[model samples]
Target: MTQTLEVTQAAEVTQAAEVTQAVERPLQTAKPALGRGLLLLMSVATGLSVAGNYFAQPLLDLMGRELRLSTTMAALIVTAAQVGYALGLMLLVPLGDLVERRRLAVSLFGATAAFLVLTALAPNGSILLLGTALTALTSVAAQVVVPYAVTLAAPEQRGRVVGTVMTGLLLGALLARTASGALSELGGWRTVYWVNAVLMIVVAVLLRRHLPKLHTPAGLRYPALLRSTFALFRTEPLLRWRAGIAALSLASFNVLWTAVTFLLAGTYGWSEGAIGLFGLVGVAGALSTLAAGRLADRGFVQWLTGAGTALLALSWLAVGAGGASMWWLIGGVLVLNVAQSSLLNANQNVIYALRPEIRNRLNSAFMTAFFAGGATGSALTSIVWVSAGWTGVSVLGGSLATGTFVLWVLERVRTHA
Candidate 1:
């Protein structure tokens, strides 16, 4: 009886050991190293994904004229896009953790393509608004691709990777206005959406073929995952601070972009092509992403944030003078782009470092707040542009930037304290 009991205990222990090893093997294995080709693809795809939302910025006037809508009604298209993007960031981005990223991204791209076509064919303001909102909502695929890129990158190289990918995103955003303007000149505003819908389809196929499959079990159900995302803001001061900074920074950014179209078209009497070409001035700022990322990797994140916020506040001075001189507007746009990009990169680096396992959730929390500010700014800028004109818009943007700087100072003091 004693011998039989001993044999039974030994068998049970051996079986437990086997089960432990099986569970641990996958955890211990390292992911394949990310390649430059794949990285570039992701960067391009991210840019393309986000470009859909901004196509209306430069074309708002043309759209308004053709659709027989008022300026306020046309501006609401921008607001709707931002609001939809914010909601998507809050809702869909968290699914990256729960689902396979490639499928989620590819599905979003396809859906965006479909909606862009809908937007192109819309006969009236109501349909256009619906299509634009749905298109922007699905465009959060860019947000998903961002964290997915971070996951593929090595820990030491994460900052550079983020910068490279973000550069693509920024370019897509700034350049979309240029493309829309040029395309509108060539064909019309509707042509811009048709072309982009095709581009989205092409990119979706490329991503489906090239993006490696990665699935990390989040172990929580949908509702719990969402609850956990919001809970992060309450528990993590870093997340809260970063999220606040993101909101203010984006608010300032949207304030400028939302109103600048009106300024250029009405005051300067610029052609759509010329206004589109103006977006190129901000290309220099987009180029700052790589340097900002490298700097963040080297531990200059806080300094980058401080400089960016200060520069953002000062850029409004140039922008205020833009109503009088094109040169001032150009300089203001350049500085504003650089400042916004640097601030955004630094904030992302900070939050991404906080909880590697829950990056999607962190991103959802941060970007939701970020785009909420953008939506608010776009909405207010339309009202401000009507009520107070260029000076009012500048004050609003500058005040938001200044507020961000103050928050950064407070964060710095708290850290030291």
Candidate 2:
């Protein structure tokens, strides 16, 4: 009897060990904690990627003068980058799963740097357009690095981690306008490209050193991979709804930017240097991005969605009230950016919660739509600015913001039902 009892006890202990080992293995494979310095490095790289994409925005006027292009033609410089970025998201970001992410990031950095140089050297409008397109396409390194950061972070801390990275990204977007404007005024528009070229070269080197080797296990075939991207469109109703809102929200954001520069420069006789200061005030929005992320993590996702949407709506509504005063315009711009960034962070937090394996692909799809809409907004702004001026631009932009709110309601209804 004693011998039988001993054998049974041993068997029970062995079973418990097996169960514990099964649970431990996955935890072991999870990414290690990211140090503060590494997070900061990622932020800087992301910021540069954002800044590079916008180098042509504030300089559109200079390009129009130098290249003998129309307003619509000049606007292409901004849209072309958006188009290229969309293409990269569609074609390149998914490879995060098939290749070593670190190598992929470095290679993208190099390609983007090369394109920046080409942009600096372009002798005519066509060559410049080509270089801008290439630079935008290759700037997918930002997408690569961001998702890589998400993967490396602890799941509980993912929102905060992503928020920090986005703060950097938003700063880049804001400062891009200021820096590009200032540099263009002081040294000519072409100087913007020269500056970007040098910065990208430095970013590539830092990425090579700071980012750890990232391994991605292959899970699907090429055709299957493409199919998976589309599947998100079909299967995830919330993603679809939120992505639509994102497109419209971003459109509103871009419309303001693409037209405001021209309006300030043409009507107000503001120099590039003066116009850049608008971006300084816009930097206040970065705080919203961080706040939204923290809010989402605390299970206040619904509240964030509501508050952000309301703020966006108010931003557009303010334009109607502030048509002539610079103070009002500045206030509206700051509010608009804050609302957009907050909503963006909240939306991304929700999407990231859906699937861990396909986060990269998912980001690509959503960001592609997000940027494509921005291109459309910019294109529309150019045409509208030429014909109707600031009033017309504001009317169009306000309508887009209102549309985003309607979509937000639809999302809320769907979630409840």
Instruction: Give the candidate number with the greatest TM-score.
Output: 1
TM-score of 1: 0.88
lDDT of each: 0.89, 0.80
- Candidate 2 scores a C-alpha RMSD against the true structure in Å of 5.7
* Candidate 2 lDDT over residue span 277-314, tens digit each: 76687778886777777777788777877787788878
Error of 2 at 328 (Å): 2.0
Candidate with the greatest lDDT versus the true structure: 1
Compared to the true structure, candidate 2 yields what TM-score?
Answer: 0.86
lDDT per residue for candidate 1 within 86-179, as digits (tens), equals: 8898899999878877899999999999999999999999999999999999999999999888887777777898999999999999888878
Model 1: which residue pairs collide? none
CA RMSD of all predictions: 4.6, 5.7
